[model samples]
Target chain A: MINPHDSVIVRTMSRMLIPLIQLFALYVLFFGQYGPGGGFVGGVMLGTSLILGILVYGRDGVPCRAARKLMHGDGVGLIIFAGVGGICLVMGGQFLNYSSLEIPLADDARRRYLGILMTQIGVAVDIAVTAISIVFSLSPINDTEDTEPSRD
Target chain B: MIFSFEIPLLILLLLTAAGAIIVKDLISAVLILGSYSFVLALVWAWLGAVDVAFVEAVVGAGLATVFFLLTLFNASPKDTEIRRQPVPFIAFLGLPMLGLLLLFAAEDLPEFSDPKSPASVHVSPEYLEQSYQKTDTENVVTSVLMDYRGFDTLIETAVIFTAGIACALLLRRDSK
Candidate 1:
């Protein structure tokens, strides 16, 4: 009862929404400073877009190269978070104290504030990548029972 | 900002939370719980804690619901009618007692957004004043999350990773 052409239309519509969702997510990420949005919101948007891409265009629609790169984004995000702290430790300040960074700032307090926001970004990216990976792994919708026979 | 809850939004939030609790179907419960989380996020937004609201919307509403749905499919959809046990009541009461203690302690908290509250007067002030200049990042929430509390943030990342792994292990099909 479903027409092939109609399916194409549906897919196209779905595809069209991806860019809009992406833009909205970015807006949330940047606007969190002044309004109601932040890294977590932005990450969800990014993850949803990828999932939407898979839904509308199927697996092939997801860019293979991007997937490969993003697969490591979680680890990279963790490294960024830890690396920031490690730098503070080496500088003989409290772990994660950005004021200790040997940067020329009028106030060390300013540097510390910047450090915190940078870390939040890393957390957001980590969340997004991990979420995407999980979605991808579980999305085939195949039942586990198919892989084995129950004797009971 | 209007502090009192609007009738419609309150009704919607109550309905969503109730639906999450009362839904007979697992998938329906997951969906309704997601709605409840979104409502909570809206509540946070109204309170002007955009950072908290964003995290709740994404993690609590989005990924958590996804995780629940995936687990839902892993098990049978049939609802089991197990009679409620009374043992949980003790723990439940203990939780509210703890909450009450915290609430009493909060009497000392700077009233809501009072500029003089310890939270408002402490390190947060520095971040508000200097984050943009030092991080060159427009978003203060982003700067704070990534740079100032980066160590704790990494631990939180590990928690998420661990949760994902735990879910996967529990949901994965066991091999003979």
Candidate 2:
């Protein structure tokens, strides 16, 4: 039932758009301090990019392997956020208290900035993975079922 | 004791909340709820709580509205009020009890963000003082949300994810 000509155009457009959206998300995450954007906004952008990819590829056209990878990535995101806090606790500070991290830089200012940046990166991954999982899981299953009436 | 613009905005917000509660149409009620959330966000911004305003805008205004709309697709429209026995006496007694509790709580609050309150004096000072130098972040709220109180933020994210998962599971169609 798939049209080869339309498929070619949609695939071409998705290939172009996905990279652009990823780059924009990275910009939002890194430049958030001086701007109105940050991890949550960046995560939503990245999530939407993947959602758009799914729309273009029509289920099977997009790799099932990638979808499985994203589900696993969701757990990784949670671990990263929790792992940083666990390290802080192990160092004798309260949970998520990054000030306790002993940096060789010998400057409190440098250490603090490093800690904040580290936590933000963790948060960015957590949000991005969670959002993508939610979107992927909620996709319209009926459409896929209808499109490929099982060969069996 | 009252300014004109502030009173109007407060009135508008209350009106939106009332409309949201009383509307017979579910979609219209959700729309009014969105309006209430937006007005509350504006009030927070006016009170100089920019971080609270941003979150209210994103979660309450955006996500709540989106969820309501998504559920609408599966929901059959119903405006008929479910008939129920009235309990005016209990409602009247409960209203005063709630008001008294609010009054007592207000008496102990920091006089609308007074600088001398323990909360304002202690936390805000350190957050404002060291946020930039420490986090290299202009947004102190971001530093606090993701760093100082990261545990609480993680729980809040989990709560949202949980709600979304629950909704999807409940709504999922079973194969025959």
Candidate 3:
């Protein structure tokens, strides 16, 4: 079989494009406050870019190994999200009430602004990791647990 | 949000939807389905649902196609190649009936962006008017998603996490 990933054009192009895609994902994540994006959209882009990287780089490549470490990363983001909400409840306000966090540096709306940003980040992390994990488990291309006996 | 663009996009969406079923090759069907999502995203953007459009473009058109391709590739070659089978007699009668029923339902839908529409008259108006003051975020979508409805999003993230773990447990084979 002719493997497209082995082609010089495909590999070179993927290497160049992956970083650009990730940069755009970050832009979508942070600037979502002003535009048509949010944590989920940004996270998908981030995860897709990593997937593209793995596709071109192969399983033993540095990027694939790095992605392996990110497998089952569902808990990290959930903790951040719930922890922020828990802090609000602990501060004598309703759960997820951002203004109750009460930083001396900012007022109610500002506090909410910061809170939204924090939660967006948390959601983005959760989504990106979950997406990666899904692709890893669903497809053999990035499988970390199994060395496919049939391929060779 | 051009009205002229919507008709063409919707037409393309329908064609792709039909083409995905009509195509025999699994790979071709998956590719056509990706285009279907792309056209649907265009429809969403044309309808002024920019955020929803962005999501459909990325998740629907992009990752989904990749995922489908991956699954198809992992399957046997015989699985990828469809053996032609006659269309079920019930499908011919049922599909048109379903489509007509959907059309009847769609006809009752409120006009696009109608100020007095149920959605417009509901709490959305307050969300739109007060989101800036509530969250200091310029994008009300983010304000609503990450602030006003933060708990909902929190649960959604947990759901994604659960899905990830489930996939891992089910498919995380150790071929030792």
Candidate 4:
């Protein structure tokens, strides 16, 4: 457990900053088609924001229910990616054949764009959740130490 | 390439690499390594590999440094002094031999941006010409990674997911 009273400045600042960081991550994920950002970069940023929150507020800062949900969501993300590929296969194309999807798009190119967008979102969600899970798994022991009475 | 700027940046990169290895403290060494990654990202950006540079900046410098710091904290009970060890004779001989071999290999490599280079002369031209038309994406890197080589990216994601699972299992075991 973290002493909520400690490091008030950092806590307040992180509270303001985490949302902004998450927004930037989403921008990176969505705008990757036209720029030097992508699922990997955006996902890492999202994870880092959560880690920053953990640093300031401790593990308990992240609600247990939320963490559990996110952990399960990692698998859901992977399934979504695979499901898209399966859809392509069922549509009489090879795996991950994005243009095969019959979206109400103007052309094959638009379908491809939408397919890529969906896949990128899945990848981003998977990576971001995995990153947070790794950080959470690693940090809990340290958190316990902080909460316990110091021997020295 | 801006020769004047590139030269100094290259020098800074070398200095950071050396500092990272030579620094006595583990924490300082990790920080210096992060700096090295940052400078390398800048160099990559300068060379117009913006996507690669972005990955380096975010993953290598940012998340990796944080992970290293966390691992360092958890692994050690206290701030243990990083002892300076004498370089082994094999390392001195082996590293230079490896470097010399690479230098010799470099002789056969085409000059940077040479049109006739194997890289530029191959599928790269086709990819550059057709990526936008085929994928409706302006970013070639994204198209290449996600569309052209989707399986590879999917596998990479699987690997990361496995790593997260492994970390969770290991850490949870320790806690219990």
Candidate 5:
């Protein structure tokens, strides 16, 4: 079982840093349209932050429930992306044709922008979940150690 | 491109790559490999590929190092121990031959960042020009991936999801 790092400074700093990293990840995800950030990078950063939490505090930083929920997020993201494509297909246009969605979008450009946003969100969710689950699978044996009874 | 900055980054990249391979300890090798990824990311950023650089920095430098370290946790000391053995004859012959082949191929590649290169002269410029107007996104790469080529991203997501599941299945198979 992998134990959390024992250094006080390491744990203290990770506690302070994880939230900031997650915030930056969200910024990268949402502001991707206007900047160098994008779904893939943003998602990677989000996963890295969670991994950092896991490295420093083990299961305390990320509860088992939360991790399991995120494991399912892998499929949720795929469903979201495919469902958006299906919506466009049902709207009487080619699959993933953003402009075909007959919504209350102000313009065709706006429709495209919404499509970009949704697709980016879906990609971000998928990548982040994959990264998290891979790490989780590697370290889950470690997390269960805390629950075991210790012998004197 | 700032030759002053680029030169050092390239040198550091080469040094890190060499150091990583030459290191005796697996942990040190992994750390050096992370630095190599970091320097490569900087080189990509210098070349004006910000999105690529971001992915390289986060995935290559940060997450990959962690993943390697975690994987190492499952490894035993016997697996990590190095044994002195005679170099294989095929490695002696094939390594240099492969290096020569790669060098020969590299010579024919286009010069770095040549605006008139075949890739630049192709449909790339149109994507850059029309991305903002069509998708209302300033980042052309994002628009290209998510808007123009959505199915490719979908497939990519599927692949990543599958990889995660496969990793979980392979690793957890014996535990339960």
Candidate 6:
């Protein structure tokens, strides 16, 4: 959906900003234990970056294929979350009993940390995919018939 | 109460809310609503509810505003005139009754951050005391959300997933 008539300033600025936004989102997701950020906020930021990309570059501006995959992979996060909980249950603890995890960590507390981190990652993935998918779904598709061919 | 600062903030919030309702243009109303959310977030943060404030800032002021703008763009651009509807009898009479009941109930609530408060004396203290030792997480909010209340979070995630899917199904034009 690239248009030759699109402004150069927006395209250039967004290209630079999008990567920084995604990086910050990742930092928030991983560093949530000691900070104010978490998976939900990080995921929203990531989704906002993708939405900005779409606004600047159009539907095809962001990686369209990856976006489609993310849309379908929305369930992946929940699966991971539930899977971890199920594993804990099978290991003779209650559901989501992270202390029951048989990780290589030195103690139960460490294992709990690992479990929480894993769960946060799952939440981040789910939220990010959902946000992007919602934006993609709601965005108006470009009319191919009326649009002129790309000049590039 | 932090009344010195809170009074002004509450006034500003009221103004923004009123402005949002009174504004004729839909876009203008949305912008005002965003401002209202921001003010509300600030008030929440001032009251030491940082997590709630963060969610309000992100979801209310950020994502919700963006979604509203997107929906606005999809619809025909029109200056929406606010039409005054007749106030229902229940709203006029029952609302005041409800408000009075709430005010009466508020008398029994523990003082703000009172050590002897039911909330402080109950499971909250245990959660605070044990969270770090049990979960190895310094942030009590994180420990509580991801560990103690994981089932609720899982359900919340499922709801969000369902919303995304529903939006996609309803909006996407089928490519034949």
- Cα RMSD to the true fold for all candidates: 5.8, 5.9, 3.0, 3.2, 3.0, 4.0
Runs of candidate 3 exceeding 4 Å displacement:
A1-4, A141-152, B1-3, B81-85
What are the per-residue Cα lDDT tens digits for candidate 4 across B1-176?
55978899999999999998888788999999999999999999988899999999999998999888887876765555677878998998899999999999999999987999888887889889998988899999998888888999888888888888898988864354
Of candidates 3 and 2, the better by TM-score = 3
How many pairs of residues in model 3 come into backbone collision?
A: 0
Worst 10 residues of 6 chain B by lDDT: B74-83
- After superposition, which runs of candidate 2 have C-alpha atoms over 4 Å from their true positions? A1-28, A31-37, A41-72, A86-106, A135-140, A147-152, B1-4, B76-89, B92-97, B100-108, B158-176
Model 2 C-alpha lDDT per residue in residues A53-151, reported as the tens digit of each score: 655665555633365476566545556667777877898887777777677764765555666666666666666666555544454455457657767
Kept native contacts, fraction for each prediction: 0.40, 0.26, 0.86, 0.70, 0.84, 0.64
Q: Tens-digit lDDT track for model 1 on A1-152?
A: 10123377777776688789888887876565555566667767777676556545544445333653686665565676677778878988878877786667436656665565455566567667777667655544333456768778
- Over B1-176, each residue of candidate 2 has an lDDT whose tens digit, in order, gives 54755887899998999898777667888889998999998888888776567557765775557546545644555533344467679899899999999999988777766778787886889899988887777877777777777778777656645654564465445323
| Best model per TM-score | 3
Q: Candidate 5 overall Cα lDDT vs. reference?
A: 0.85
> Each candidate's TM vs. the true structure?
0.69, 0.70, 0.91, 0.90, 0.90, 0.88
Which has the higher DockQ value, candidate number 3 or candidate number 4?
3
lDDT of 1 at B118: 75
Per-prediction TM-score of chain B? 0.74, 0.82, 0.89, 0.90, 0.86, 0.87
- Candidate 5 lDDT tens digits, B65-165: 99998887778888877665877999999999999999999998899888889998898999988889999998898999998888899999899989998
Q: After superposition, how far is residue A46 of candidate 1 from its true place, in Å?
A: 1.5
Error of 2 at B113 (Å): 2.8
Question: Which sections of candidate 1 miss by over 4 Å?
Answer: A1-10, A26-36, A56-69, A72-74, A87-121, A137-152, B1-8, B79-111, B115-140, B169-176
Clashes of 1: 17
* Better candidate by TM-score, 1 or 2: 2
Ten-residue region with minimum lDDT total, candidate 4 chain B: B74-83
**Between which residue pairs do clashes occur in model 3?**
none
Highest lDDT among the candidates is held by which one?
3
